[model samples]
Target: MSENIALAGADLRAAMRICMQGKFPGVQLYAHDGLTRDGKPTAVAARAACKEEADGRKLQGPERIAALTACFNGKRPDLAQRSECRKEARAKGLDGADLRKAVDACAREARG
Candidate 1:
């Protein structure tokens, strides 16, 4: 499978863990758009839209993957900056999870 697909799988796994912890009763739907500077994992624009029945209560689902498949298949931005960041992290022997956390921090900063 492609790198984006792999990353999306990883993200979905993480999201699943979150959902389980949160005890969300609805099916999870994810929609990803755009990419971070790093080509490793693209940015995700995800939402969980619960299916509702006629009584305005949630409905069980056959599950929907939605546009997440498309997002993961789309072209990513340049990896130069992302590579540099990873290289720096590696050079310092930073923890891999820490590096990911740092990347998330940067993304949040950029978003604002």
Candidate 2:
């Protein structure tokens, strides 16, 4: 694992949040030209992601997050993305079960 990749929850979130909120300064999203399958630049996907994040923040507790983490193995999210997730975990104090979940998630993705 690269030292840049935080294998833990809180640490990873801190790095990631920094990147997402533009704190890192030069990072850019290489998304699909902000377009959808319908050839529309509506940014619906971006809006939905933001909405989902807001909604997820409402669900308190690590167990709740753990359940969500258990289902989605995004197949080894890149170091940058993992950093963002770690940043989010830090803000939310997701250091317990969430940390375990993050480790398990990394392992699962690596295995695949």
Candidate 3:
């Protein structure tokens, strides 16, 4: 693990050096074109992602959201409740940004 971290650090340092020297294209660095793995245009991918996020957010009503919050925070003592929450999340397609936000919020609350 230490060796891997050292190698990654070295790679990042090399990249930073190249960027500092202005060897890398500034447009390529800032633009999303040709950056996608699936070959879809950036705008198409972004629109689809936004629509998916909206759908996921819309799927969870206030009650479902409260359940998710409780489950994520481990406030629900019963394992079954957690299981149910997972099932519901999957059923409602909680993924991507919405899921990330939920988990992050729950983590913050847990830390406090």
Candidate 4:
């Protein structure tokens, strides 16, 4: 995972606010779009104006994690890796000889 995940748009700012307060609404749209229509840019550009507002807040570990989770669309690559392993064991769609490589591929393709 990247050290910094850019939180873009006004909506994201609001989500961050809620997350900092130790709350993450499951039904809300944390990001305007997690992955764009075209997957060229892996990450969004940081909005400088919102940076000041975001930086001012101080949150505990869980709060910070919650905020980051929403900001990143709650994608867990680790979960993807585990699922890939199970699929590979079933020998269904996955035809890869190396289980480790197959799991890695599945994780890399996960959208966030």
Give all TM-scores, in the order shown.
0.26, 0.22, 0.22, 0.27
Residues 1-112, model 3: lDDT tens digits: 3554444675886666567658755534432452344433344444455446546766467755564545433422333344454555557788878765655555455446
User: Per-residue error at 14 for model 2, in Å?
Assistant: 33
TM-score of 2: 0.22
Instruction: Please report how far candidate 3 places residue 73 from its true position, in Å.
Output: 15
Worst 10 residues of 4 by lDDT: 40-49
**Residue pairs in collision within model 2:** 12-86, 12-87, 13-85, 13-86, 13-87, 13-88, 14-86, 14-87, 16-83, 16-84
Mind giving the per-residue lDDT tens digits that candidate 1 earns over 1-112?
Answer: 6554444677887776576757854733332223233323433321121111211442223223233322233422233345455676667777779988766665455446
Extract clashing residue pairs from model 3: none
Report each candidate's C-alpha RMSD, comma-separated, in the order given.
Answer: 16.7, 14.8, 16.5, 16.2
Error of 4 at 80 (Å): 7.7
Candidate 3 at 104: error in angstroms? 0.4
Regions of candidate 2 where Cα sits further than 4 Å from its true position: 1-77, 102-112
TM for candidate 1 is: 0.26
**Residue range 1-112, candidate 2, lDDT tens digits:** 6565445786876666566758645654333355544443434444455446646767557754654443232322333355566666567677888866775575456457
Best by TM-score: 4
lDDT of 4 by residue, 10-71 (tens): 77877675776565545443334443334322234223222333456764577765655444
